[model samples]
Target: MPHDDDHVPRRRARSVFVDITPLRESPAFAKLWTGTAVAQIGAQVTIVAVGLHVYALTESTLAVSFVALWALGPMILAGFVGGALADTYDRRRVALVTAIVAWVSISVMATIAFLDVSVTWPYYALAAVNAAAATILGATRGAILPRLLSPQLLPAAAALSGITMGLAITVGPAVAGVLVASVGFPWTYLLDAVLFTGAFLGILSLPTLTPDGPRRALGLDSVLESLRFLRHAPNVRATFVWDLIAMILGSPRVVFPAAGALVLGGGPITVGILTAAFAVGALLSGLFSGPLGAVRLQGRAVTLAVAAFGACTALFGVVLLGTGLIVGPGAPGEPVVPAIVLACIALAGTGAADNVSAVFRTTILQTAAPDDVRGRMQGLFYVVVAGGPRIGDLVAGGLATLIALWAPPLIGGILILGIMLVLVRTARGFMRYDAHAPTP
Candidate 1:
């Protein structure tokens, strides 16, 4: 057996952030990261604002469900279009354009908030536009990363991303709650606009990245090329499918506001706390992830981490069950959540597990795929990572109304654990994926 020291390559590989102060050496990545970190917080704020506003206006969970269902189709369409664009153009430019479009859309949303609440159509339209734009930005920005760093550092970069996401989700919702409480929706939207400006600075600073092979502009041909590429790559398919399954069954984000309002008894504070706790868990896990670079068993790592996430999600469901049993469903007028601490802890565990899975998944994509096709592949990856949650939002929204808030996660978690086992067992080839030896 190869001992730990013997297993690790001794050639002193450079990290993804590079050596020049992790900022000066890779200003492009730093800029992009900074923009994303700030924007993610803003996103959380808007998410809270929209959910609260909708619930406050209509006082029905089904109305809030419409927000997610409304955005789903446009997002799916954008995924294919975005993937093609990522492969065809300079990814940084693509990201910049999308960010600008999204920024403008959010600005429009802020302006509309000044009008009547009955004007709901504009909110839905603007939200869909922002979702589509965000999808595009996510795909292209992911494709740009490999150009900015060497292969060995991909794991470290993934860890850094997880840590950032954890912090963003953690801080953003907490701040969003406070802001919504004090400043109201317009300022929240305005701040999101300002933070979005940083995204342009990052993308504009990047080096040009022309396609390696014959460059086709975004259209049917680009989509066909991406489809053809996917046909031969089982690992890529597995990665995307695994991600979708995890998010579909395990993500509980959509139920949070309702959980706070109905089950937990604390209202918005509980909602923000629960979401932020998830990020806090992710952030904490990343700090001890120093040896992540040495873990060549990425396939197993992703599998186990996802499993842990499912387990925690199930625990969150149990918290819901306890809330129902110990406290019963709240009266019609009550909007406060109960047993919030337990809920937060469960969410934190889920976030940490999901972050571990994400680090492995990102490294696998960056290391395995060729640079030429990587843009499109990462685009699909973004679709899976992003689109799945939207699907989860739909699932959570509908199911919470059908059965109860607890039913969606309790059932979803069980389904995730079962499906993951079958998928991993059937695709054992993925278990031995090697970063140094890329395969289809």
Candidate 2:
């Protein structure tokens, strides 16, 4: 009996580290992961480039923030329509088609930048189009994952996604800052357009993944059905609510430009470093994510992670506040080393915590939801994921204009912490949620 118990403990110990079995076992998953990891680097470059470009053109933080605002409506619509389509059609085809559209949009942006159009509206319009197509691609690709891998591997897959995201944000922004400063914005956009092809290749290699259950026609009725299902699914609904609260309150990307220019000061390079710092934390966390998969109480984990995220975000705000007090406001061309270091540490903490929350949240959604409605749920999930940041952009941008640059995050962080506590306490079911027996 003692020897048998020792075997169980050994197996449990081994389960603490990230399981790469999914990648090794599924060729399709490997291709998808590799392609996405590469493509996302380009995507991050474009994201940072666009913000820097807009800020350079307009010199307005509000204008830079509007990039996300313009993309919001189209993204929400795409999430709904594309998710429904993913459920009704072959997800692989859907992803491929949307990837082409995104590629074209990025190509157009490159052309405009190269031509030195000097107008900001075109950039905003093209960005919206790109965002819409990306949202669809996101929805379709998310729905395709469960089909490609086993349920038990979903947590590991989510951890891998953290690595993908972490690497993309970490490397892409740092590179984009250099490219924007050296070669300029047009080249940055062009690089993304070329990199976008990796996603296409990945999708192309995927086996046709159609919905598993009774097929529902893609239309208003199908969308309505998905919404109805979401209405009753308390645990899943809690995930969305908690995530939205955290993002809307704690999202600080909109202010990175302002932080670099007016606060932290190394110009575009500072923005890149600040952005990359967060991903560094996430990347490190993912790399060491051996213990996360073995945890059974996913809900409790999410709550704890998000709480940590809120605290870190609040600390970030404080760092900015200290910078302003010590270094003084107004754009100083040179960087403040101490403030930058402190801010980076705080942002890294936020990244680590957020990644942990994301792993569990994604695992819950993929495991609990049935295949028939999974696409639609994933679509809604995409909307929450995408829209929350935009809303934060608006909140941060609008507030910063009225108050100090650091004010929005300071207030928002406290709000996130308070709201999340209330939400978790009220929703008892969510607190007790178990991965082995998921409740959608």
Name the best candidate (by TM-score).
2
lDDT of 2 by residue, 59-154 (tens): 998898789889988999999999899999989888988999999999999999999988899999999999899888988888888888887888
lDDT of 1 by residue, 323-376 (tens): 777767563245334467778788888888888888888888876777778877
Clashing pairs in 2: 16-290, 16-291, 17-290, 18-290
| TM-score of each model, in listed order | 0.84, 0.88
* Predicted structure 1: lDDT: 0.77
In lDDT terms, how accurate is model 2?
0.87
Candidate lDDT scores, in order, read: 0.77, 0.87
**Alpha carbon deviation, residue 210, candidate 1 (Å):** 1.2
Candidate 2 Cα deviation (angstroms), residue 185: 3.9
In angstroms, give how far residue 17 of model 1 lies from its true place: 14
